[model samples]
Structure formats: structure tokens, C-alpha cells
Target: MNRGLRIAVVLAGGLAALMLAGCGKHETAQATAVPAPAMKPAPPTPIEVKKEEVGGPTWDPEWDKIVELALPPAMLSGQVPHDVKRFCPAFYGMAEDDKRAFWAYFFQALAGAEAGLEPTVQAKHAQPEMAVKDEVTGRPGRTSGLLQLTYEDQKRYGCDFDWERDKQLKVGDPDRTILQPKNNLECGVKILDKQIIEKHKALLSASGYWSTLRPGTVSYRVFAKQMTNVPAACAVHNARKTVDGTR
Candidate 1:
């Protein structure tokens, strides 16, 4: 071979080797490279709830004193006076301590407003027959008793039970009189229970009445008025811690 030809062949061979080395490096990089790991979805969050609150007056020990002072003289005369406690067992559950306190306070206020807890023997002018008479004479008046059921009241709550004729046969048993303490109280509580059930459509504890009847409302006033001497009676009863303490 000539010197020029040999030199050209040698340069071509060197160029070919360099190109093959570059190809090998590219293939090695592709094989060694790694893909990123697959991503995971995040977890879900939780929900929260809120509770409701109730409100009312705390039980007071001295509330009984108010009831005792408000009871009728007849109640203190060693006789069962006509008042709310005598009839409405529900009233005894007005507070957390005992329902009797509520009954006593209620009747105490009622007795103070009405005839002082003496056995209301004589049918007052507020009696149904008499009130109707008074109405015709242009003198409308409210009736008496722990419930204070008026003349018109007889038409509504007269005979849920005929305790007067059924329980006792006295011509005019003051205790059993429709407007007297025992009868009036029984009728009143029954009426209230019926009203609550009718309105709410459920059975209620004694405390339920106070909770349902908001203070300063007409219902509270009417209830308080009907249950006169209740505070005084409660005070007397609590002080004695005996049912017969008033007597």
C-alpha cells in the first residue's frame, strides 16, 4: 500500500470506533434510569355534632317559707285545707328537690288570692249558678278554689270523677266541693295534664309542667293564681317534713 492510502484508512477506522462507543453509552443510560413511584390518594375527614342546652331556676330552701306564709288559716287550723297540693300530685315535681315544694308555693299564692284556706263551705257568688245570676245582673266575676274554676268552668271540668257523691255522701262536704281545695286541686291538675298531653302529645313528669309553662307567661300566672297558698304550704310542709305538718 501507498503511504497516503494507509493514513486515510487508519483515520476512518478510528472515527467508526468513536461512533460505536457513543451508541453504547446512550443505551446504558436508558437501562439504568428508574421511574417515580405511584402516588396514593389522601384519606377523608370526619364530621362533628353539637348538643342542646336546657334552662331553669335552681331549687330554693326558703321557697317553703313563702308558701307557709301564704297558706290559708283553715289549712293551719288542723284541717286539710283546699289547695293545689291536696289535689295535684304533679305540682310536687316542679323543682329538683321535691314536687311538694312547688305544690305548696302554688297553693299558698292561690289561697292568698282567694278565700283564706278555710273550708270554702258556702258557695260564693262566683259559683256557676250564682255567677250566671251575677252575669245576667251585669256583674261578671271570677270563681274560687285552687283551680279557680269559674261558673262557666263547671261546664268544662265538672265531673271527671264524682268524688263528692262517690267518695263521700255529705250533703256539702267542703273537701269534696267542686270548687273546694281537694276537688279543685284534683280537677285542676287533671285539666293541666290533659292540656299538656293534648298540646305535646306525650306523657310528662311533674317538672315538665314548669318547664313547659314559661315564667311570666299567662299560663304561669293562671297556674299560680289557682294554686294559692302553695308557697306557704310548701314552707310549712318542708319545715315539718311530714305531710300532716300543716295541721
Candidate 2:
């Protein structure tokens, strides 16, 4: 009689424990479940701000301002392109004083005359027949850059001028690089220096390299007008290193 009673009691106690644990699990499920929010997440913004600013030239207020102020707008029609084909080697190799005073005016005039002061636009010859074709694309490529650096000039100067548009877009593309005035203007001044010093053309103002250098042409007038403020030593006759270069 005692054994039977004890077994029945143990079975009832086990059943009660199981019922209690099932109720606890139901309550825990109710407590943990959550409903979703009504509103959708907002879209990300398109604006992107870089931590560091891309580098550009700290244009010299001293000489740069003078060059900026001097050039007249009427002169820049791309009719007379600046002779920037050799600008990279010529301008970079000149004396500092010559660079500041005379050469800047000379080159800027050519650039203004050639490209109308925009680096991206190519300079075109006023005469339709005289335009030179691009070596790469076989399309007639116009002169480009602040110096009216031509397609020919790019090859002549050893600057980057890729024939493939995609390749040029990636490397040594003058259209992109010339936009940087630091590179364009710097190379322009040097290229002009080459005409007088290296080529022995003897005339910064009258070099046969650019028709603008010759007197009586509209290009020369722009050159003369811009030089009104330049020192007297910075003239066509004195542009060369020696008189022997005049030939």
C-alpha cells in the first residue's frame, strides 16, 4: 500500500512541473516579440565632401595679377594661336626676371590670341584651310591650353598627347592637364623662352614661329599693348641670350 501511494504522488508532481514550464515559455515569447516600425528608412545623400581639398596653384598676386589685368578681351579670338608647340621647354628655362616681366606678357598674348584665355578650348586658325590634323585621331585637332598648345606642340614638346580618347583621358591628356594653369601657364612661359633662346629666332615679339610676333599684325599689337607695363629690357631685340640668335 505505501509503495503504490508514493509512485502516484511522484507522477502527479512531475506532471505539475511540466505544466508550469510550458506557461513560462508562452509568457517569455510574448515579452520578447516586437512589431516593425511604420516608416521606411530615408535614402542616402548624394553630396560628397572630401576631408582634404584638391591642390591648385597659389597664383602669385604680384606678377600674376599684372598679367591677368593687362590682356584685352578683344585679342583672344583663336585666329592667331599662341605658338605653344615648344612652350614647355622654352618658358621653363628662362630667367626669373625675364619670366615675370616680358615673357609672361608675350606668352599670355599668344594664348589670348590663340585660345581666348580658356585652357580647355582649342585654338583654331582663322583660315579654315590652314588647320592641322591631329596625329592620333586623324581629326583636325585645334590648338589648346592657356598657351594654345597645339596637338603638334604636344608631340614636339614631349608632353602627353594620346591618340586614343580613353587612353588620353587616362594619361597625359592635355585637355585635362591644361586646365591646371599651374602646368599650362608654367609650360607656356617656358615654351616662349625656347623660341628666343634655343631656336635662335631672336625675337620674342617678332619670332617667325608665331605670326603674332611680327609687327603690323593684330597679334603683335596685343603683344605691344600688354608690354606697356613691362620693363624696357624685355623687348624682342633683347629677348635672346646674344645678338647671334637674331638670325
Candidate 3:
């Protein structure tokens, strides 16, 4: 009960209170020091097409009718812009034949670049990612036929390639649906339709099925070289207007 003893006890209590306050302040500082979430990168912007023309050498005589038949109405109307970065101008006031011919040239050019127009050609990829196991065939992935399509495309895009029937046949047999020119090109048409019409992607998107359509790749130059003969009606050099302006 002495005054000195009481003073010592009070000092100890105040020291404990000070220590608790310091700890609380330290915790508050730590809470405030947490970093903010990082921002994601922007998507690639689409490029607008300024002109369309073809100058490639003539394709096989037979492919013209096949491509014309496979083309959907939207492509002829210029509603499906294959050049996604460059906006496609609607083919207003143009003849159906010119539009059809232009698309035929485009496909012929694509076929030439993809497989040298060889229906039975099968290409094995060198890249580690592309060489992964095929989903349908359960073998190393290989791009087959004129459009260089994979067996997995049958499941992914409802393509006509039948792996079960194909496995029984020889590698280059024309009897295989995937190796057939008509089936392969038709499958390509469906894939392009999904990209342009269903997904609203550019004809030449980074994530497109065909590497030949992707810009800045070595294969893209091959495809570009084949575009020398696009129909004249698509190239309105003096129009001086955007796709929106065309509307």
C-alpha cells in the first residue's frame, strides 16, 4: 500500500499500453502496403483494307467451278470480310460472277500456298506445340489435304474428315474424305465461315486455324504471293473511301 510501490505498478501498466499501441500501428502500416492488381494488355486492333486485287498465275482449270459452288452467299456479298484487320467493303452494285470469280481466285490462291494444290499431301509440323498428339487419330499432329487441315477438325468444326475410315486406307489414298479435294475445300469453307460469320474474327486472325492466313509468319508470304490475281472488280483504286463510306 506504499506510494512508491503504487507508482512502479502504474509505470509498468503504461509501458504495456505503449507496446500494444506500437504493434497496432505496425499492423496498420502493413495493411496499407499491399500492392494493387495489375492491368491486362489490350487486344490487337483490326486493320482496314485499302484495296483488293489479284495477279497470281492461273490456277488449275477444274478448281474454279468447285470454289464457286462452295462459297456461301455472304462471301459474295462481301459481308464476310476475310481481311479482318482491313475492313472489307461490301460488293454493292457488282456482278455475282465477279464476286464468285474473286472468291474462287482467293481459294485457289489459298490452296496453292497451303499444299501446292495437292489433295493427298500431308505435312508434319516442326514446332513443339503444333506437333502435339492428334485428338482424332491419336497420332502426331499432321496437316493434311489441300487446306492442310487436321483430323481434329472433324470434331471441332463438324468437318467431313473421317479418321476411322481414313486410318484403314493408305496415307495418300484419294478415297479418304480428308484427302478428297471437294471435302477438304468444303471443310475450309465451313472453318472460314465460323471465323468470319460466327466468331466475327478477321479472315487473318492471329488465332485462326490456318497459319498461312496469319500475318508476319513465313507461310503468310506464300499465301500473299498467290493473291496477285484477285478479280478487278474488288480493286476500286479511285474510290477514296472506307468500308463504312461504301455503305
Cα lDDT tens digits, model 2, 1-247, are 2323443554465457546655746776756754321111111111100111332221122224234333232222122233422221233343444344333445444555555544565455656644657674465735556566544555665544434443347323444654445555655544544555456454545545565567778876665554333334334344443445755
lDDT, model 2, position 75: 22
Q: Please, what's the RMSD in Å of model 3?
A: 26.8
What tens digits encode model 1's per-residue C-alpha lDDT throughout 1-247? 3323443554455457546655746677757754322211111101000001122211122223333333333322223222334434333333322343343444434333333333343334543533454221234543444334443344454533343242454534454455445555555555444444334322223333232234455545544444433333244446345565555
Alpha carbon lDDT of each predicted model: 0.38, 0.44, 0.66
Consecutive 10-residue window with the lowest summed lDDT within model 1: 43-52
Best by TM-score: 3
lDDT of 3 by residue, 166-237 (tens): 899998888999988888888888888888877888788789888888889999888877665455565534
Indicate the worst ten consecutive residues by lDDT in candidate 2: 42-51
Estimate the TM-score of every prediction.
Answer: 0.30, 0.45, 0.67
What is the full ranking by TM-score, best candidate first?
A: 3, 2, 1
Per-residue lDDT, model 2, residue 47, is 11
